[model samples]
Target: MDISKYNFYVGTSRGTLLFNSDKPNNIQSAKSEEISEVTSLNFGRNENELLIGYDNGCVNIFDIIERKYIKTPELQGEGRVVGIGYVNKSIVIGKHDGIINVWNGKRNNYFDTHLDEKGTLDTLVCNENRHGVIGTGGEFNDLKLWDIETQQCIFKAKSLGHDMLNLPIPTSVRGITFFPEDNYLSVCATKEGHVLLYDDRAQRRPVVKFLEKKASYTTIACAYRERQCLAGTTRGYMQVMDMKAGKCLRTFTNFTGSITSIVCDPLEPYVITTCLDRHLRIHNLETKELLHKVYMKQNLTKVLVKSIVKDEPVEDTSEKEKVDEEYEEIFENMETVVSSKKLKKQKRHDEDVTDKPRRKKKKKLKQAEG
Candidate 1:
């Protein structure tokens, strides 16, 4: 599936603009000014409207077919809007002040609000089944799953305490995504470079955690029909993880800067990632090969690859083979008895030599006595 037909809307500190990816990397300037540093963006499910959430607490909707900005009267607001998602005909805007505003597409009215007055909204996501989940990236550091219709928090996963490991301190949950068919939630952070898998039906602790030391995970997407998850890190690395086994399946390190966003091709398992290196890259899931790369003048913070094909698989390696290779590496790194015994013997030898009497000490003591 080719993404050449798709146009890109990028939000920057200066303003927001539309760029045709098929063009010569030149942005078609939109009329909006000072777009509040777009922190998150989402297109409507039917591709009718494009939603842009900004740092200055404004959510703007644009008409894609008509190529005009829809002047939604009630949708205008002033808060640090951090995340945006579309569910059915509803547009969800998550703000830095911890309020989730739901907007109706037909009427263009503010329908509901899910407010957590204590925390900040870090990420907002909606699955194929229309289940909406919000990750709060503040001192609370928890994931809240809500019923969009009722605006009630159905489930909550609190953050694990600090001092738990030698890993970096977690800033806030940068992103959260649910498995396509399962009850699993993939949680990523801005500080700790790890993807945590938590089962909603189970207790609070994560069932599996995939930790990497390179950089923080800024965004993640699940494969089209598999249990694998694709993640983008701040260091410009893209990795696929099998949530079932809690291991990284494949890794691609081609981007020159931090990866800000990632999304799976709607039709296939191919993954698309945007980086601060000012490039958009498409990778085939099966082969872990980069299919396309488009350089841009703007540092892309988010990317979405809307697919026209429905149910085709991208060519890549098998999941089982990848898992086995990861397992082999884990076993190879296991400490051996011989190494443990040698370390103990060395410690004992150093203690014995230190405990022996020193002629210099005796001479100093005699001098003091005299």
Candidate 2:
């Protein structure tokens, strides 16, 4: 597969850019003075329009075919626009003040609000079936699902708790994703350092929880097409988990700083992670191999890969490739074994401490001896 044809849209702290992922590394200036800091981005279904949400309460629409900035009346909000997603012809923008605004291309009065609280919109996800789900961070640590057609919140799940006196508000729910080919939802955040899978059709609590070291999870991506999920941790590690078994299958540790964004190639099923260390890495999920690495000058906040062709041929593997696959599988399984052992040891230590009897010194025994 020609990797160069894949175009990447990167949302940075300074602004956003379109870069050619192929050999020459061509960077195109997509947005100019329109945005000061890009907080989120979404590409239209047609791939012609690029929507960028800024930290200064502004969203810009760029025409990719025309190669010019298309003017949409600026979205007005009280806080920074943190998340953006596109479904059909409508644009969903989530703000830091816990407000979701749906903008249709036709009218100026086309704005529908879904959330009204004090929280940062961390991620906006549109499922393969075009279902809209929004994950909130900071003050409100919960995930809320919305029905786009009716513009109503259908379900809300609270996953994290906080102390009202010291911390006051809930910690951030950094990432949320829908499982592949199922109604399961995966949520990850800081403080607890665990990935939670919740069955939307059943109970309120999580169905399974996969714990990690004390690293804040910044981003997560579900390979709904590939039946796997990838999580990017604050400690610069990428954990690939099996969605069905709720297990951490592999860990990639090439990054030096916190991982800010993670995504899967829609067509290739390869994982791409961007980190504050200024490196973007492409990993093959099946073999756990690092395919490509690109070094950037700036701290990459978000990295998204756009598959040019919808119907690409799958690569056929030979006997030699199968041998390599076996080796990769062993490496991945070994990591899981080590992690499980560590968790077991930690649990045993906790049990030992809790089971220890308190020491009591009796004054009556001393008096009798005297």
Candidate 3:
């Protein structure tokens, strides 16, 4: 598999690290852009400009190509910025303490609001094609969709009802992401090891919910397919799920620590992941194979795949040639191999004929005596 086509950003404990997938020693000595730890990441309309949310609840606009700061909008807060995204010309930021801030560049103004004033949000995602809509959820809050323009809730998800024993199951949302192909569809992963799919047009409750045993999902990402989502657990169990069927389609293993973040390539069959084990990895979603792994030196939080300016396909034919060479090695002495097999058959025929002749001679001697 050729990974040289992708360029992505990984958020770490120190800062955000940039890497190209083609490198042999990616992120080996790559310096981070910011000093503060990155808590969230998003791309602007240009795709070249990146929006970085810091643990300090501040958002910075950075040009990934130029490797420079584009803008640092003035804001003061003391919470982790859990989400950052764009709507037309405005920047919307969601903090852990349920505070949501939106900044409009046209008016050079901003507004701030809270999600009911009390609970913390673990996941906040802006709908890409939904025209200024966003979704936010957490351990204490139910999954909700909001219209950023009016600051009103468009839909609110109801928590799971009582169990078979009549005991209410708690809601703990760990990750949330909008399906790229559908504006009304969104998926969420919870600490309770459940993945829920919601369509705001259908109902406030999830249309489908699937449970992955022994998996407390830490991160979730929507695959390029229509109704597929990839989920990663704290125990490093990763699997692709068919959200419509509510079943696991395939699983990718061999991870050592918690799966902190996941990102699927928009135009490729690759899934990029960052883990607490300090390794950035790319896996082939089609073959369930680990294509590349790079060690970053610190725990990674989030990763974003940048848009490709130009894509040049790279194929390594050396492996294919090596396999052909191995096949040739098996019968290097082709004539001798054939002769040896033939020689074994000849020996067996000689033994069979010699015994029969001996029996005939003995019978002829007995007949002459009679």
Candidate 4:
């Protein structure tokens, strides 16, 4: 639909493609240094810089304005980076070994710590309204909010027991995001195919737990202005969940594999999703319509939906029309001129043949009579 306010960048196994949401087929590709698969991506506060983490445990910073790689920060862990967030002048990275590393531009050895050794960090996000609040969760990690200033976890989701089956439900979070308008509120996708909403002010329990899909949910994204969210499953199904009602409003089933990432457009009624099927699809949030789809050759693991670049040039329809008109006029003139020249040459050849025949006949008749 109307995606003039945002640019979409998809991270695939081979490389990344930067393009407009309106024209996803037309793309500008950028690859990682070693061509490693991009595992996570996050943009800075101003949206001027992008941070990319690869499967090889290497991170690269890119200047969006220049559309070039700026630098690669030294990461301590030797595993895939699953999550990335921004805080003031530094960035926080969540690795597969459950290690959270913070790095600024100046130093290599800045802030590093492990949350857990058993499970990987599957989701990471920051509260833009609250500077120090950061959320991280994964398998057996539950959901925890960290205070970046104090470097401590402020809130954590508790475990719950099953009722009739006596089965234990471990809080394995697949994705996390804070409501853009409220820093106190955050949401996460669970391994049980449900969405959980948390309030920092009331940490007693989750305010609501909405079941989105039948399969495990691998990613979740909060809408720009509404209390609605988008959730993707391991089965490639996408669901639109309403946090206020704690129910699923709609479902989209077109992906052939697990959904890797989801992002909502801030200014438009659209959502972008990247799937392990090597395809990216943009959908209309309100109308429940498929807007644009692109088939990437590589398996996509993540995507960074960037803000719009201001003052972009609009399409010049007038120039295209003028060129088309000039081409048609030149073609018509050339066709008429060629036809006229052929006719004139034919007439001259016919006259010459007639006159030559007459002259030959007269000479032969005179010879006969003499």
Model 4 lDDT tens row, 104-158: 7665433444556676677677777788678888887788888877887788877
User: Which pairs in model 2 have colliding backbones?
Assistant: 4-22, 138-172
lDDT of each: 0.66, 0.68, 0.80, 0.78
Alpha carbon lDDT at 214, candidate 4: 68
Taking the tens digit of each residue's C-alpha lDDT, what string does model 2 give over 1-370? 4567577777777775656634535566565675467767777656777887777878887776677766566665567777777865677777766566777876432333444455455566665453555444444546666776666666676554445565643445777676656655645544456677766678666666666757668878786454477888878788888756778787888789988888886657588778888777788877878888777677778776776656877676787799999999989888444588898999999887776642223555566789
Q: Rank the candidate models, highest lDDT first.
A: 3, 4, 2, 1
lDDT for predicted candidate 4 compared with the true structure: 0.78
Runs of candidate 4 with Cα error greater than 4 angstroms are 2-5, 15-24, 108-117, 307-370
Which number leads on lDDT?
3
Model 3: ten consecutive residues of lowest lDDT: 106-115
> How high a TM-score does candidate 2 get?
0.73
TM-score per candidate = 0.71, 0.73, 0.77, 0.77
Model 1 clash pairs? Answer: 57-79, 286-315, 286-316, 286-317, 287-316
Model 3 lDDT tens row, 300-333: 8888875546767776799889988998987785
Candidate 3 residues lying further than 4 Å off, grouped into runs, are 21-24, 28-34, 106-118, 311-370
Cα misplacement distance, residue 71 of candidate 4 (Å): 3.6
Q: Which ten residues in a row have the lowest lDDT in candidate 4?
A: 107-116
Full-model lDDT, candidate 2: 0.68
